[model samples]
Target: MRNLLILGAMAFCLCVHVCSDTQSGPQGDTTLPEEDGVLQLKQEHFKRALRKYKQLLVHFCKLHSDLSFKDAAEALMGSEVKLGVVDVTQEKDLVKELNGTSYPMVRLYISGDIHNPVPCPGVKTVLSDRISYFCTNLHRLSHLCFFVQELTNAYSQVFHAAAVDLPDISFALTQNEEVSRKYRLSQDVVLLLRKKLDCRKHFKTSQILSSPVLNHALLFVNKSSADFEEISSAFSSAAENFRMKILFVLVNVAESRNGRLMEYFRVRDFEAPLIRLVNLTDHVTYHLPSDTLNVEVIQEFCQSYLDGKAKPKMQSEPIPEGWDQKPVKELVGMNLEQVAFNPDKTVFVLFYLPYSKASRTLFPLWEELAEAFRQREDVVIARIDASANDINLSTQGAYPSLCLFPALYTERSHIYIWRKKYLKTEN
Candidate 1:
């Protein structure tokens, strides 16, 4: 596994390097013509040519292998709008002049206004669909989409499409008066959106239950906000030591309103301020022997888990008949797209084998989520047996897989798959 990951990383780097070199330099025999749509801009010809286009869309990318870069370039091939590709590595001075710090950066130049360039808003990665959406509606909206206000029909459609297409990205609305005043928001509203990391700090009950990180949840369960803050601070300080190797989360036992997880971990109500490290992969756990939770102790606990010296503990959860209820609809090939691509709702689908012990064990958790969100009108939770259904869904190598299909306007709907590792053992 380690070798495969290393090889994958190396291959990715090589692809990036080769692509960067090709785009930065000249194509061997087949050079793209200016009319081909994407213009290759350099330090020398950057300024003069940019001013010529009435509306210009420029993509500053360091690598040719950047999927978003390629996607955006293809989306604008036959359009009247001009697309420019700048290889940042070869044009360091030009990138500096444009004040670009991130690679695969995209900006729009309109009406020969080189002084104030309009940046694609709420964009962290170069998504072709998102870039095209933003550019087509650039004139009607603000230069940056982050400004809070009423979203135009086109803008809303694009924003929601991007959110559905990219599961890691979350779109949030902030209506705080103070925040609006502080930011001087034009529309008295702020659209907060960003790509979420897999190892983000806090985990709500719904997220924890649905997350693959349930296999290895280093939970700091606490009753008081003060204790939660203290333990979270300590974990944050020690988190860098583990990086992506482990997931650290804070579970406020009292606030989350989810008692099943506490029961699964056998955390008593009296044990409010406690730290427990669960290894769902092995069905074992390690509890902090001491009451004092600090950065040093947390680091030591993590080190012990890595060293495989942590003692095993049994998980306890009461199995009820209601737990066996099927809230997740079984999806077949014929109805898969019909149900998944419903324009009114976002669908979360789980793919699993009926006979697999691991699948059976996790089914209750998914049911619990379905029951919890049963009242929601905008979401649908469903499951499909992979053996029975031959449809291609992103599994990320896990048997019992979960994927989210968002309802967006596109020829093909994007599926967001949960790629976290799952336990294969029956134990």
Candidate 2:
């Protein structure tokens, strides 16, 4: 009972807090302090606070400006969250360190992301609305860090390694009875403090809107499905090991409240018991091919992802048979990177629509251009069906476009050299 109560508090804690952090940079030695539940933080305080707090919300404001968020900050800060304010006007150095040139900015620094703070928006809204807005951002939940306290250790080195790898999760093993009394746990059993995100209640409209950019893993299930409990248990167990690396969520396809999320993921009701993982940074989504959702299988799927064994869904068509048989090699999505963008070879590509008259007129000219470079093993000429595939470059999206990826080209800073003089079209 005591353990259960404590878990409840931790769950409630998740709904009130958010993130912030700064590295241990050289600063003047001064004892900064916390008063009225808000830390009067300086440049040096962030390093200390980074080690102390799991979730932090920092408000950067001009001291003389309107103190509109004072009450909202107080209401948001609790045992779960530590609130701090920086006087941007006075601490010009701190402002620069935080990469800020403006006042009245709110940034949340979570445990893992110390160098980059997540910008907290909707600060200028009403006090009630501000709290409401903060509550709905699924990322800012009841408690930032989860704690599992018991006498017997229920987990092994896998859990320990995970804790070390992801400092965002707080795990503790204690043989203390007093801890349970607070939460009312009486028996000696394996109890893990955890929070599960059910799409019906956890995912708000804003959260749904931001799903593409979020590191999200979702299990879509049906209430009437016979394997629902087994799958749910396995998914939750898998989620424990991933902590800050992934935001694991579940959705009931049968519930109308979850319909919007289902549509967003393009999940049909007939496709219950499905699992998918999405990368937040790259916006890539991977689907699990198996229908079985067991502990071993789910963990393997997650482990494979962490090991980079899974492939993301990219826009590409199948490579045609003997793609390089012609003078101008025909390229597809699969071979585009290795052939057209080869670092050792200077490459040129013609992106054309086969059906376009203008595209047809360039075929003979393209063949001549390819023949010119055919003898040079250091250079290659290629043509792709642009209308049938995506080149992933903004400027190369249009049909009848020409591009050059020289030997000096880079993945981050790629350029296209389009030659517009060879304009021949069948009128």
Most accurate candidate by lDDT: 2
For model 1, the local distance difference test gives: 0.61
lDDT of 1 by residue, 59-139 (tens): 787745533434455665564456777888788888888778576566777666776676654233434354344323323
188-263, model 2: which lDDT tens digit per residue?
Answer: 4334556664423465555554554366788989978888887888888787777666777887899998887776
lDDT, model 2, position 319: 90
Our model 2 lands, by Cα RMSD against the true structure, at 18.5
- Residue 276 lDDT in candidate 2: 81
Candidate 2: stretches off by over 4 Å:
1-202, 208-213, 220-226, 251-273, 289-291, 307-316, 321-329, 341-345, 349-379, 383-427
Q: Could you tell me how far off, in angstroms, the CA of residue 163 lies in candidate 2 after the best superposition?
A: 30
